[model samples]
Target: MNLLEAEKFPFQQTRFTRTSDIQTIIKLFSQFSKEELMKKNQEVSIAGRMTGKRMFFADLTDQSETIQLKFSSENKKFAELDNGDIIGVVRGIVCRTDTQEKKNERKLSVEVEEFSLLSKCLRPIPSSYYGLSDTEERFRNRPLDFIVNKQKKEIFFLRHQVIKNIRQFLEEKKFIEIETPILVSEASGAQAKPFITHHNKLHRDFYLRIATEIPLKKLLVGGFEKIYEIGRIFRNEGIDARHNPEFTTIEVYQAYENAEYMMNLTEELFHYLAEKVFEKEKFTFNSHNISLQKPFRRLSMIEAIKEHINIDFAKINGLEEACQLAQKFNLKLEKFQKTVGHVILAFFEKFVEKNLIQPTFIYDYPVEVSPLAKSKPENEEIADRFELYIGGLEFANGYSELNDPTEQKKRFEEQSKQKELGNEEIASFDKEFLEALEYGMPPAGGLGIGIDRLIMLLTGQNSIKEVIAFPQLKNKEKNFE
Candidate 1:
């Protein structure tokens, strides 16, 4: 019978006492000379999977580095060992490979006095020398990918460091981290389609939050300032190298702050990560060598369009003129995009967005595109909004929030009209949010950053899958290839 099919495997051990891990052993004794190691002759107990050809010599690896294992001679028990067998404990004296030492090699080995099998790997695990090359297969079977690719494991470590540092930085500034409901009655924060599900007990449908902006702002009205949330967001959207249906985002709100203050804070937070967390000044992202050391460029959207192309948006005074310009450029406008503000956005996206290769702040958006943002006092046509772009990708968005209940109601009404006019991604008319606005919220700044995209930029990864451990992929036939 197969070993796993037996009532109990005769070779398996229940437990063992491990004195240290392979990483600790490598770090502590790698610098010692062969003679120095022999002088100490320290005894240790370690457990790991057997990884090489098992005969008189083999390798043992844990979560960290691998170590060599040596026996006096080939025996019946040693010959039965195969790669991927989990050893319970190899209790032995730590010493150098005194007889088979190689030039410039310092990895110590365990002179095994005794060991037992903890478990047997019934499935075959590929060699660590060559990891899984098929991208789809690697993503589908993440455990195997992690087993063979050391760098793949390192990416998650870097991701953890990024989140940990962010929390530490905000905590130092007295910013409180809060969590909002994932299943919301209505999704109104962002302009995206939401995933819907029925709540059996409530007998009503709920939406997986597309953005955490709404509930977090509600907390601001309930007498909390300088709050933020780092949580998962779901969207019923298309997938690409940059997008996943399920992802992470962080939304921050600060009462008594304006758009300019939030912009400065965004820049400082990035600089802190580069200097304090990673300690690196330069990064290569989207084939561009971008640096975090320099100050970011700031330009208005209309100005960017002007800089990229010779078209002067300031000259287009009316909707008729904007329509004529759109016809000249062959720009197609949707049913809801019939206004001058929409035309301005169409022109900016077509001519300006892809040219922003470095870190830039594009500010002063039109009111039609920014409903939650406050309109400028001097010019009601423009909203006090800004977005951060690096490598032609949007990383952060921030604006001075609209605190007027009456104006907010008007905006939602406009959104309702648009929803009827073929805009499927319009924010719902959230009456509760409007009521919260009536309760008198302070003038504040709200900012949101996509955590996965930010990780991709910082890690120099082009595809979103490299940063995310398990991303959504197309369903394979029957089983994953």
Candidate 2:
């Protein structure tokens, strides 16, 4: 029958007296003989999608369980069924299949007495035999992908468990989960371009948030001691294996804490996640075995650059000197990267980031790149910031937040200058955020972890799109071939 006729049928009003899962029923009667099963007279109602059929027998599956259905030749209802059809069997007897080759190798099956069609399938499902191997098709048609591929379905199930464990861990530490606005007048949190939309009523352009940092910190100023927000962030950027325009991030903030405290907390949290998810402190990702057992290695940005490129950035006297060094290393420079701090960052990105293969905290970022981070007291040009890297991918960024209103204002002004110089990723000056800082916000430590990349690492998936459900894809015109 067609789907329309199946929907109009009276099967919706019909109820089964008792039903057990196919796998459960099979396990319960695996050792029972045919005479024993008949003597006990246990009956059950079971339903599943028909996967295979022969002359007088059929195979049905629900989720990951499968069972064989035996029917008499006179059963007209069983004769008319097709593969992929959903059907229910009533008062089916459980019996062991006949096997003369081995005494202990008998299989359990169901004997259907009365049956009814619950639904009809119009199209055949994509099968492993026919090959559902296209990556684009798998991502675009996630429901079908899950139905066909057991491993892909398991990954998403693990994703759910990962988020649950993270929430449990945070709540155990008394961290209050909170939400911030996704639409804002200004996206001042991070150095990323925001997606803009026009409000019809207000006749003003609003931005989708690029980061949850500013609002979460504002909550800290509003008397909350510890707070976190797990939400979607949008950045008008290019997409790659490691980057997506839309992504999930968990931004955490704690008052009366420094960057070092945040680093330790991050390590602890990762360790906890590793042990809970993988049942060990060491897990393999993309062929690399990573260890969360030891303390994550820590190195200053300047020291890392020195170790990788044999150049002491401290000796670079001025912007002209840094520019000369960049030219010497054949590094490409952006228009706004003329300052010494900017040049150091460019060099670090080109020469230092990939060398950090294991879990390492690369700290002491240049002040130019870290607008919201507090500057180091001994070296004013460096900020007390650390970025966690695993298998050469950045997983977390945390820093001692800059609470001085005057310094923050100056940094905002500098960012405004960068914006004027056509730096689209630089955030515009946010007067309201500076005003909140003016209200004497306490010293704090804040962190933003890329949830998708973390999942990819934990699940051994290499691409960010593999971990994200319904990741953005390029638009294509229909060919209708």
Candidate 3:
């Protein structure tokens, strides 16, 4: 930024040293009485941006904390100080003060005996109250947003702690972390459109991974009993409150475990995070008070439909009848959704999904929509898959993985047909993943949670953009000089 009034204040400090920060000073001397501090007379060096009103008393803030600074207005250097100036307080005495301006309240502070202007804040730091009302403005300029709205720091702090505890929880269970490739020949694993890029070296097109599931599953096939990946996933899709083109997900797999076992694991993970990171079972998200303390409610897809809409879907025998039911509910069916299974899912999403405000697992997803999941032994039409929903958004998906190569091939063919029928988001027929399954991978369960959405829920953020620091925005030319 260009310096405003440059000729007035020249030669800002190139480097300055400090012995203590505001937080350390407060921690060390806040307990002592006024007489005790006067007797001890601790001298320290500190530096931070000058925040708040500046007369004799000013608040100097660093990342750790903010502390008061008292200076003489008569001192020419202090007299010329501006709010937002980066300055160092040299040989400052830790002291206590009482003032009528503070309603006779005693406050711990520091007396600024000597000072130095470390840097002249070239651009005026945006006003804390009036200047940052636009949401887009705040997002486009995150650094200024952090300075103006200090409370925003807590969101990221929670984000860090949440991810840290996730590693801790999974490590305690002996789950190894493996980073998979970002660019791949096939963006298979979950059904989503991929961001395609050409590889000049290989002379073939590659897609950014839409999910970490395929490679992590390969690790499982190569005989890692338990493994997980916290990874960035790219999808060629629209951006909205819950959807980002690039997002994060944690996909975990365990050998010799089934969908039911994974369901239990998902619940335990959430409960552990609630008690461990947040230290509470209740959280407010999207205007709902969700509790992780209770056992999560579980229901089959058809059961969930019945519970919410009083419609028993199991009795709907054929596509014609299902189509009629969709018509009755005013739900439009796309060309690829011309099956009983697809129509059942359509009905569930339209009628039941939003009603799952608290933690609820709706299982027995249609095999048409869940190609990687094993089919229930008794019901080949239904996959042994479940999705955990909270605050009307799907937080986690888990299933008993399909290990039979032949069945997996059939499912891939089904998905290819769906893609031909105008469904852009369908799993690819990954040749390598199929080859891995042919080696007889043990029957296993896999679970995936969108880390961004989970953080949004835990932190009470309504939009995905709030949790992410640099969310993508529409193209606009910079007109700045």
TM-score of each: 0.94, 0.89, 0.93
Rank ordering of all candidates by TM-score, starting from the highest: 1, 3, 2
Give stretches of model 1 more than 4 Å off: 1-16, 98-106, 478-481
lDDT of 1 at 158: 86
Candidate 1 clash total? 0
Backbone collision count in every prediction? 0, 0, 0
Q: Assess candidate 2 and give its lDDT.
A: 0.85
The reply for model 3, stretches above 4 Å from the true place, is 1-18, 129-131, 476-481
Query: Positional deviation of 305 in candidate 1, in angstroms?
Result: 1.0
Model number with the top TM-score: 1
Q: Which sections of candidate 2 miss by over 4 Å? A: 2-75, 87-116, 129-131, 478-481
230-292 per-residue lDDT for model 3 (tens digits): 999999988889999999999999999999999999999999999999899999999999998
- C-alpha displacement of 367 in model 2, angstroms? 0.9
Q: What is the lDDT of residue 167 in candidate 2?
A: 89
